[model samples]
Target: MIDQLFLNNFKAFRSASIRLAPVTLLTGLNSSGKSTVLQSLALLRQSYDSGILMSIDGDTDSYGGFLLDGDLVELGTGQDLLHEDFASNPPGADPRISIAFTTTDKQQYGWTAQYVPEQDVLPLNLAIGPSDWRDAALFSRRFQYLQADRITPATTYPRSHHQAIGRGFLGARGEHAVNFLRHHAQDVVPEGHPLRHPEAGGHTLLDQVVAWMQELCPGVNLEASEIPGIDSVRLSFGFGGTAGLDSTRRRRPTNVGFGLTYALPIVVACLTAGPGSLILLENPEAHLHPRGQSRMASLIAAAASAGAQLIVETHSDHVLDGTRLAVKQGRLAAGDTAVHFFRGNGAGVEIITPTVAEDGSLSEWPEGFFDESENTLDQLLG
Candidate 1:
């Protein structure tokens, strides 16, 4: 859904503009500024959702304060957090982030945020510009960003309040995963019904998700329940095998495998997102096996086809392959997906754009790019 993104004096990007498709895949080696692009989009969307942007107040004791500290520190030190080459201009130069995107209905929107360094504090300013075109009304929704190290596996469970689990948005680290489910239980199912009714699209969404997960790991069924004394909800899994079926459910999230917990939010987002929504995901393939990773890619493509605009930063070749497969299967059109690879050089990082042809083949592939695993294997073998 996003049409374009522009960055100036931000992180490793001195000045760069990238065109976006319905499903945009950002792949690069470590420190190639892939996460920076997602972070910028997250901040932009956050600003819009919150309706105001403030400077990094050093005294606040919240996550926003920490984010402010991190952003300013990154800017002040001019160090590439991911080990890439990131430099600040001579002096007195302001850093700015600008994003231009179009909604599903074809309305265009642009937002620019600028930060000016001061003696001991930095002043942040935000500006909302007119979209180049207009169609439908645009609403601000929460931006989702999943870092590589922060993924929570699905095998974990959370505390619950009742037998019924609700549905809500999953937190970044999946901390509120169970609570999210419990809160949105109504959306998960219709009133006075145990099985999903035909008219309830949300039920169908969950069913599709379960069906897909079964393809990855056979005999796995997911259900939600609320804890007796807690306000949170927990997830339980039923396994089928030769020995009678067994079920293992936990109230604490720490018990499950990291992959399931981490991938759940992605699945939920894909199933729940509506038109004009923007989802920014970093390393959606983290902790997933090759097959699971490929399946995840297909899920993302399906979400985009359903009208959500997704920007994914990944290092998994399976993810790329999945996208290509989606194109080949006619689930996604060639023009609907864009793949950008970032390569670092003395001048900074340059981006290579790969086009998906009608036959689902890439127009070109960059050298020494997106082969982190292969490069490591070669070094070890040699």
Candidate 2:
């Protein structure tokens, strides 16, 4: 697991070191540098996956450097990524962007990319870390990054053998989720795993997914199947909750309410998390009601307890409260969870971390940190 993330002259940060916990919750206002934290980590992973993040041979330009455009992230160019107000370098030295991280085992890995405004591939003049760093969670196959702009409810989803099967990846936008689910439905969840839904019908992955989805919409079960002679998969739903209703009738994703389909990737991602996993989530509470959002937080907590390191960027107060409830209930330790609120401070972004106590109470709640409901209530009473 990554212990800390350091960003120097990257995007909105001139120089910032963000602490990461087993389950880190990053809450903030719009453009307050919350996404930048997640993007930087994605950028590093994408660069390394493209064979451009580390130096194997003496030559650093061709074989290794930061690949700005790739499968993970598409940061346009050095100019777009570099911080605008970077501090001056030493005499005759050019400006550069650097990203580095220290793991829990005290292993430090860093990369420095030259600043060429027009070029996307920032050639590294200096790189540090051993090749064995691939063993780290960041480079591991268990890592999942679900961006905010995910796939909407549709008739059918794409089926990719290499990505969904070979790589075991639910696409960045979770576009391959249905296909991945169709393939892994029969796989049994590890015994005594936190992912096992007690109310689920069986120990299989699909059962747990349906059990969890039922939290959002009671008695809703889903199925994923391959389209005959096509590179697409179909996701259909069945309902058993309504009295006197026919549960056999199937419902397409377009018919099964947007919240469940929109939140499918998150459910699958959390259920798939295991030891040494690194899951990056963006607004996992996007399109759900208050209770459903809180239940999603419980699922996230369960994943962390199962030994995955999750860094979540969210805008939901219910998520925050639910995570605190997890801590209070001993599902997650107070020390193992970190909550950071990001806000602009006139000069640059400021990250404020509050303490979580044993009673699901926070040590501090900054003025703008989930205080909108209270503020509005005060106005109504006045």
Regions of model 1 farther than 4 Å from truth: 49-51, 54-114, 118-126, 131-139, 151-168, 185-205, 241-256, 371-382
lDDT per residue as tens, model 1, 265-339:
677667666666567787888877899999888888877776777889988899999999999999888899989
lDDT of 2: 0.88
Q: Show the lowest summed lDDT stretch of 10 residues, model 1.
A: 63-72
In model 2, the worst 10-residue window by lDDT is: 240-249
Give RMSD (Å) of candidate 1 vs. truth.
7.1
The TM-score leader among the candidates is 2
Across 1-382, the per-residue lDDT of candidate 2 in tens digits comes to 8889999999989999989999999999999999999999998889878766766334545446788888778889999998998864774578878999998888888888889999889888777776677777888788899999888889999999998898888888999889999999988986789889888877889888988998888888888888999999999888883211235788888876678888999999899889899999999998899999999999999999899999999999999999999999999899888999999999998999998988888899898999999999999999
The 0-to-1 C-alpha lDDT of every candidate, in the order given, reads 0.59, 0.88
All candidates' TM-scores? 0.74, 0.96
Shift in Å, residue 312, candidate 1 = 0.5
Assess the local accuracy of residue 36 in candidate 2 as a C-alpha lDDT between 0 and 100: 91
